[model samples]
Target: FDEDYLDPDSDINKMGRALALGGELDDFTASLKDTFTTPGSQWQYVSIDTHVIGMVVRGATGRSVTDLLSEKIITPMGLEHAPYYVTDGAGVAFVLGGLNLTTRDYARMGQMFLQNGRYNGQQIVPADWIAASTAPSAPTAEGQIGYGYQWWIPQGATEGEFMARGVYGQYIYINRADGVVIATNAADRKFREAGVSDQNIAIFRQISAALGGT
Candidate 1:
């Protein structure tokens, strides 16, 4: 996220409706050229960065995203149900926001993070990565919900408080200090409404506080 793409008439926005319907990703990426010749010059929430990284992994590993996720995580987590990813019209996995999982399965992921990436007596993800990624290191606005590697650290986050927030209303909030994991799901398109995210964070903090008897 190092470019400015806020223009309503931006190339990506021109066919955004079609893209939402099922346009090819090539068309989408081509529409939006890389604006940041040098990254770290700025910080913007450009969603395509993740899809590009997913493609890189696919290219480097000669493996599908599903295969890698299943082998390295999903199967090991012993989820109650199999998960599926939503693909684009070209059949490429939509790496950004296409991962679909059951609420319990997501809670398992949250629990893994809560335990510093350990789950089911095994280290699923490196504890160091879990700590570093969830840290509020991003250059997000001060006093707002902060962005970590891909997690959300609410303002005034307490010891081990963070969340994974889906573009849709899916949220997995974990408070390690309280040993609480709250996974919620919704399709409210109005989730972007003002104060919605802050309100949700406050609610999660309240829940955690009550559970911790603090």
Candidate 2:
């Protein structure tokens, strides 16, 4: 069966809910097996492969995502509030969208990116990783939004203009030219509407301009 796991109506979504509720890794793998095997062209736009990322990180470092993140990023950044993730019953951190962080913490991350991965005189994320991840590397159509490694490069954006976007209008916008970072959290049910993403970017640009990032 050609299972569109990205589809809300698909069986994978049901399995995803179970995964969210502390299901096992084997269950998630089974869900994938029940679906299509090969990735389609749309794979460029969406991929639910974060489980593999968690596995790789653990295998490579022999540490959990929460531990690595806390020791490497959170603690070094000196965040006012510690971030957390929804985990499986096995305590495997959800590598995709399970992270819960305060808006201030989000901005701190954006600022770190803006400063080439340095925060409070400490190197959080590697500078090369920041540059490579934020670069326009995705095969997107011209004048459309572009995807970098887990980051978004808006249409018409120059170098150093990128965002970390999340569900329900959550955003950490960085404008390096004018030294601006904007963090926002929202409960937007209409986020999938046409032009919503563009409008959000426009609003962020307006905010950036207002903050002397022009």
Candidate 3:
């Protein structure tokens, strides 16, 4: 959380090093000062954890996540324009929050998932993967903001309801029962306020209901 990442013993120095000095799994420390408990013991919202999954994908497939995203998801979705990922000094793409895509494209992605991974008459991504990824499998406490593979399941979310959220007010809200997808981008400073996320989800629900969706 500190900008002075040069200190060797900083909280997130390993991740900073991975971004700058060509990160390797061996160089990473599992938790920051043991603040986190045993793995799978609980759910913690850490963006760096997303990078580990990206690295695993890169290592196992011998391909960059960016390239795979372009080939497998972006291209097949028939987006209006090509999307890009923000990278670190080591050219490693930030798979968690670095994706830059048009709002329309975001909605298209939501629609794809809504259709169970079929887009433009093609099964771009596997329906089973979509189902599994959007399920509430994470260890987040019940009645709270649930989580799936990398998606957010807001409180009071009905079945097949999930979202991809950003630090700001950015969101790609999807509700399959309603056949709705709402993509939004915002920079509201009060995004972290209590009830903000719930309010946003409520608004989306109202909109979906208005659009003849569930």
| Residue 86, model 3, lDDT | 73
lDDT of 3 by residue, 1-214 (tens): 2312345765455566566666643245344345446767877777767767887898899998888988998887889988877777656677657688899988999999899999999999899999999998888876688898888888777889999988678999998887889999788867878889888988998998888545
lDDT of 1 at 110: 96
Clash number for every model?
Answer: 0, 0, 1
**Candidate 3 local lDDT, residue 6:** 42
**Candidate with best lDDT:** 1
Assess the local accuracy of residue 11 in candidate 1 as a C-alpha lDDT between 0 and 100. 51
The lDDT for every candidate, in the order shown, is 0.81, 0.80, 0.80
lDDT of 2 by residue, 1-214 (tens): 2235447876547656777777876457545653333554443443346556677888899988899989998899999987878777777777766788898888898999999999999788899999999998877777788888889999999669999887667899999987999999889877767899999999989988889647
What ranges in model 1 sit over 4 Å off?
A: 1-22, 34-38
Clashing pairs in 2: none
